[model samples]
Target: MGVVSVSLLRSSVFWTVDDLQQAAGRPAFAVLTQNAGPLQLKDGVASRRGFEEDLSALHEFITHLPAEFSTPCMMFTSTLPREGSSTIVAAFAAALARAGSKVLVIDGNLHHPSMHEAFGINARVGLTHVLEQHATLQQAVQTVADLPSLHILSAGPVPPDPFALLLSSDLRGLLQSATDRYDYVLIDSPPAGRFPDAFYLASLSNVVFVIAKYGIVQRQPTARLLRKISTPDLLTSGFIVNGALGVSE
Candidate 1:
């Protein structure tokens, strides 16, 4: 019943995490991917099948994440523009919230903010306001009626110096405060290899999830970028390939 099913057709079409684990002897990512159909993006949100697949993949990834962290702040990033990191973070955050986790999504990509656009909300105030002391987190946080547990911190008005703002001590304090209040803090940062802002956010987060768009992300540069940001304390949750197997680029 519900979304869970023992039947193969229902299981593959809806969800069958238990059956997947029993059948595949591996994680749910591969199984979900196999069952996923083509996806279309409308207003920055993935189609149903694609969204479900991404949610399952990310959920499985989080399930395996070490339980040592009491409050996990995960940053989703990519090596280049148009890598679908923002879309993934948005959908992933919503999925987490729907599953009863309190998730705070911080739009750290000040250069080209997309959370407001994706959620169709006016970005009158956001992270910049909080960092600049113009607004408190409670004031900056925007909530959607449908997703009660998910909150968004838009990039606010794009500042003249985004890098400077992101590196500010206030930003660090905000991250700490957010992690304390929320079950998971999902940060959508600028491209990893192209912008220093991503590295800064990644340093502050306990987990880093890299998105590599198929065909768009070259192997060598991504490798170099990963090595550059690699840290012992940071939990790099490995790469998630966007547009995997004939999906749009």
Candidate 2:
């Protein structure tokens, strides 16, 4: 399993590529450092230059990946919550949409769903509603005002049992339908090691990308989590190192 590491950097954060290489024991796939304070979207489009540059780089990396990595559905998870996987998923989806590829971003993190806020859309009805048969996919799916190619499916109200809902056959059907309609589907899932939700989601996705906080995430635990969740039916794409800097291109 060859792993590619991507470093997401903040302006003030400073760490060397060697630091990450030593920690992950893998070469870097791409280095994306942004001085932009936070992701800012205007009219459902990336407003900040730095953020746009980073997204462009990420999109380039994904496009250049091996032919086997080309898939309609991709899931992004992290070693733990708040590692910035959700932001990456959103940015990547927007990048795809800007390139004229229809993209759907699913907020699979039912426990602490926030993708709705990112896109400035309503989350009152979404994946949960669809899974529970409370709403149809068309009713729950939201389109970005300006970015017509981009769509979002928020987590909706927190379900009583998120794991149970994710495991339902309805979830599979939803993904299948999404893949049929969209050129790409990006799912933002919960932390892998902290919850079983990521594992189950990974099985349903064609490719899984684990996001690890550069300094905070430990190698052994991350490695173990990858091993536990990986299956022959799924492709574990690689690692995305969040919050670090100073890497040669």
Candidate 3:
């Protein structure tokens, strides 16, 4: 299946909607036209200028979403780890919060949780604790000091079997509770190609975005992952191309 949309981030070389349309062989539904620089955060607040154009594009995309999806919950995953999916999630969530939307970012990457560190919060009491009934949702969710509208639920301690933990009923409950409270809920999951966790998370999200590092990520695996996760109920909003050198004709 063809991609429904495409977002580019931190490209070392420039790219335009025309360039991406030529590369994808179809018009993009929404494209982040600017070359986003590395995400900059000072005391947990994202720099507006660093992601302004990207944020504008994202806002435009969200604004055009179907009306039924009033409080959309989105997930970000990649073909492989360290493909900058986490950074993308963080930047986008921060942008939403800065724009006065109450946003919650869940560090669903149970095996490798970095959202806590990214937001300068304690990871000890988070999603795992809430899932296990050791902590309440209120307790596990931490508010970012600099960005009051932003909240985070870190993955907490790494579990013996991250996938098994994700299977618990509490995850759905947590998501339900989150959607009831936040304007947007963004989840960060492990690499979709290497783990089933991403698929599971995709099933629970309103929209899914696969992150692919430009030069490092191969097309076959990424395409395979996208095909596997796309479904009628879930809007597989296509993928983000990160750190690209340049687009070739």
Best by TM-score: 3
- Give the local distance difference test score of model 2: 0.73
- CA RMSD of each candidate after superposition: 10.4, 6.6, 6.5
Per-residue CA lDDT of model 1 for 24-53, tens digit only, reads 232223222322222223433544555566
Cα-based lDDT at residue 92, candidate 2:
74
- The lowest-lDDT stretch of 10 consecutive residues in candidate 1 is 31-40
TM-score of 2: 0.81
> Which wins on lDDT, candidate 2 or candidate 3?
3
**What tens-digit string does per-residue lDDT give for candidate 3 at 204-228?**
8988887766555555556667777
**Alpha-carbon local distance difference test for all models:** 0.72, 0.73, 0.74
Clashing pairs in 2: none
Candidate 1 vs. true structure, TM-score: 0.80
* Candidate that would win on lDDT: 3
TM-score for all models, in order of appearance? 0.80, 0.81, 0.83
Q: Model 3 off-target regions past 4 Å?
A: 1-40, 43-45, 48-50
